[model samples]
Target: MTGAKELDRFLAELTTERRLSPHTVSAYRRDVGTLLEFCAREDIESLDQLAVHHVRRFAAESHFRGLSPRSIARRLSAVRTFLAALVEQGRLTANVAVHVQAPKPSRRLPATLDADQVASLLEIKADDDLAIRDRAMLELFYSCGLRLAELIGVNVADVDAADRTVRVTGKGAKSRVVPVGRLALEAISRWLRVRATLVKGDEQAMFISRRGKRLAPRTVQARLNHWARVQGSPTRVHPHMLRHSFATHILESSGDLRAVQEMLGHSSLSTTQIYTHLDFQHLAHSYDEAHPRARRSRRRRQKTK
Candidate 1:
């Protein structure tokens, strides 16, 4: 089958039959679409004409263009899955990209702010209606360890203040209830008091924009960036950073990986274990500062000698 037509068919199936989210379908389209472009550049006419060498070349080209290993792996997966679908349909003889391997992604620890840094970041006073909403948004993000999409998807009724918990729809449209911190509950209550002012029409969203509609992710990001600069934070603060901070802080204090995984809505314990490395980093730093035999002491001794 021709690259363009075949890919279009597969993406339509992904959207219609599989019922994948628009974001996921778009990702699959991009990855496979890039491979089709690669095939065209190399003068390979159709999906059947493509070879394993072409797939490897595409990966090499992706690396040359500065794509990360993880990104390349995803792209490779997209290509492999697409070919598998074609094989089932009898358009291709076999999945040529099946044996192709993308480089293993390295485990990089997520950046997290300390408790003091978080306190400083969340020090925004509720000056106006918008400010009140922003404060609540920031609080809920840190309090719940929510993803950007999850935070925006929340509705007013989703928060149960009396119960001190919030029901959020996370990835895959899966819903979970997470506990709300005292500060988040307080901030949310303050926002609710002033929320009626912003709602000119019937908007059921938890967070509203100046137009009285649901707040966009970009606006949330822009506001958070402004606050991070104003607070004199060394790192560029983003929503995920708040989540990482929440997870790391909770793990450090509670030392409960399973509980954290549940709170994070992570499907696997392995995904949650990355925080253990971040925890170890703090321990290593503390040891260097406190232990006499640490490299910190060695540096002091060398300087004195």
Candidate 2:
């Protein structure tokens, strides 16, 4: 009957009925709670009393307050989900939030290093044992297009050096067999051979810290940053940058969008299309150089010979 009671019930439904994760439920709770606060300030009391105008006004206020389109969209999605739950439970006659569309987010392309920079990064050598491991890490990240979590989460048994492939368990626990290049395979083999020296009898993971324990994502990130600087790259590098470069390079060379999609483990082909833009840029440059019309005479045709 009351607003607080209705909100509590809706949140319960979100967790118990909708089966949302705890993190997701917490985010939705925060967003919906903010909306309720705004409703209170505007003297609106109950779920049944809520209107589409209230939602529009809240969005306008959020935009005027300098909230990014992405943040506002996320918040609005939370509200819409909450309202849908309320409507399903008979707390409201209809879902009003559905009528208003959220703002579209800008699609910014990810930055990737060129082939030369990648070569420089992977070719740098050092004598230290950890240096070897870092090399292997970057190589695999770029070589296989692995996510940071997938790379660090690799177990010893997952790698198949004889076959030049590794079994990666990616997002949603989906497993895919990815081929490793010769350079990456060599680096990994070297690391494995000497791994026992650094980490004796640790069989749980493929890569570990100096303490013979599995490496954390942050440590991997820090090591990459250190090497990126040492290699004189213009910008700071992370594991994902290597992965992006891998996808971009593979797409440029093969032009097989489907293969790249499979390698990246993207569920949607649309998500993989961003690399096509990079491919297009490459094509444009090639056309400018190779096409006869694109290469003009240095002297202007002698003014109508």
Off by over 4 Å in 1: 1-100, 301-305
Can you write out model 1's per-residue Cα lDDT over 208-231, one digit (the tens) per residue? 987889989999999999889888
lDDT of 2 by residue, 94-126 (tens): 988897766777788888999999999887685
Off by over 4 Å in 2: 1-66, 74-95, 285-305
RMSD of each: 6.7, 6.2
Please, what is the TM-score per model? 0.71, 0.73
Which residue pairs clash in candidate 1?
A: none
Which pairs in model 2 have colliding backbones?
none
Score residue 246 of candidate 2 by CA lDDT: 94
For model 2, what is the alpha-carbon lDDT of residue 128? 80
